[model samples]
Target: MQRWERRLSDAAHALTNCGETYFEPDLFRRNVNQFLTIIRTVTFLIAKDKANIPDYEKWLSSAIGKYWSGDEVMLWAKESRNYIEKEGDLELFSSLSVALVYSYFTENDASIEIGRSELLSGGIKKLMRLAEAELPHGVSAAAAVKIERRWVANTLPNYELLQSMIYVYSRYRQACADLAEYLGIILSTTIPTAESIGEGEVHQRRVSYVKFSDKASYSKLTHRVEIDRTITPPIWLKDVDRTRPNFEVYAEMAERTFLHFGNHLAMVFVFSENGTILQHLAFTPFDQVDKFIFWRDLAERILYLRAESLIFVSESWVRKDPGLLTPIAQAEILGEMLHVHEIKRTGEVSHKAWDIERVGDQVSLAINDNDSLEASGFPNYLVPIREAFTRIHKR
Candidate 1:
């Protein structure tokens, strides 16, 4: 590897570390723009040489061309590179024209006028293919930098994790919104605690309560007194969790509501805070959640659910029953705390915020220097995430 190619490899390494920062796009973009400057140098250094292969030609046409070229895989790097320099993205290219672009760039089609002002998809693909085809020839320009295929080939393990997290996060936001609205209409109030309820009035109350684990038992509780002239039955509340002491408080309130209101009121609904207990509410039949459940370590469940909601509605793919996610949508986020991590070049993340702080949705990252995660949030998203670990994590 020559000095320049080696530099390019280092830059790509930095680019791969962008995974830890993916949760914060602006930071990722900032870091990418900086590292690309180093990598783009390979493009220029090779541009000056006229030999078996230039650095740009050699690097682009490497064995790992496909992974490096895919838009979804490297959108951040490519778009950031283009936008940083040109102040815009390279426009989508026509697939049909890929061959033409290839022929023009690598053949006799220079007669065709291709504008430098715009980048076409076909052109990019053609470039990648040309680079891939040229793999047989090394940079005859005397290893400007001793670079190898390894620099850009390997997939960042955590990169996939970030993608999955973002996938779930987006879904959770959408699903939670719809579920919140549903809860607003269905729930009489958000008060998890009331002033007080007495044993004598408990039977008189027109409301009934039951634990989630004991949902079947709710029907047995009958109103012992007809305190109201109308003498209606009570409303029923399905507290999301009965294991917690707080569950009793909610149950008593439901009983109080029933003692007052009677009949046509036994609607069993769970609060959003009990997200974990509401696992029964996870509705997606085909989803990443199940994969995590069966395959991954149990401790990572919180990481999955919090970063990507356990009951995520999953972006624009709307469900006919957002009600399926009611357990997560109702709770309000009270506050948040941010923690920064240092993602080493080896793809290992270490604690310690290299000066990362939440400036907006992103942090102040200099060179993918910090992998910051702002963890603390409202119990609605947290409850289920926490509960999942307790339920599934190996003891």
Candidate 2:
């Protein structure tokens, strides 16, 4: 077995054994059913026209039958439903489902290989095109409602419709994987120790690269880039009293240092010497409000753009409010940047600054730095940020 396969198998074994302690039989069945569903969906998408799909479905049904109607599946489904209702995020449910499906494929190489073959089949492409055609175009909200009404009047939950949706979603997931791979490559090249940072630190220092494109004045468009990084102080520094002469002097020193280099992306490397990166996040730019809306509906579009190599840095000011997702103002700027970058591929990198809440009363500020690098078809520029923590007492 390949290394990835072995890792997946080990994970499955661990999960199975753990389930055995609390509720063995039911949990086992539910897991098995989930695996079967993934295989069924992937294999079904592989067939050229639906000729061989029935056989695959039959096999999946049998496999699922062994686990379906089990208490574990019911319990998990209930929990999933509760999460969906509480969060009011359909994307969460879709993400969970996709993760489960991918887990199954990871465990079985033969099944995934077959599914890959089917995915590349011409029949699947035609099905994708048909589904795309069904989606509404530029029209008034009332007109869209009318179109949806007409669609619902004729549409039925038939096997063909289900199959087509599965195909499209599967393609989308594949595209995400491709984008991740490309980004990984670029990060590797640009950031020397991109993969060396531990996962824990990476999570703590999560930074997002949001790209923006312009809809109006497409010819004069440009890229808006932003960088978000986490910062923590050293233990010794934290131990010192905030009012102490040395402590106050050092605090001001650090703030000044941070602000002085805030506009420079190159400063991250220098800062890394003092701390670590928790996460490196990046996404493609959106062209307009409608495009942003579409992306919100299909989270996979972020991956699609990455795969196409149409990504740029977003300006810092656009992400001033850290909690919000895809701010409208930022989207507009990003759209313009995306448009301009597409044409020229080089320009002055814009920078901005913002602050993030830290563990105590102290706050950490980050400067959004920007740089335009030639596309090397890989993620060579992603430097993994390191985390540094310090404790500070109120004086």
Candidate 1 C-alpha error for residue 105, in Å:
42
lDDT against the true structure, per candidate, is 0.30, 0.26
Q: Which candidate has the top score in lDDT?
A: 1
Q: Which 10 residues in a row give candidate 1 its minimum summed lDDT? A: 142-151
Candidate 2 wrong stretches, greater than 4 Å: 1-7, 10-74, 77-279, 284-286, 289-395
Residue-level lDDT of model 1, residues 173-262, one tens digit each, is: 223233334334321122111111111232222122121212221211222232255754333544434565433443344334433343
Q: Estimate the lDDT of model 2.
A: 0.26
Q: Model 1 Cα displacement at 215 (Å)?
A: 18
TM-score of each: 0.21, 0.20
TM-score of 2: 0.20
What range of 10 consecutive residues in model 2 has the weakest lDDT sum?
A: 144-153
Which candidate leads the pack in TM-score? 1
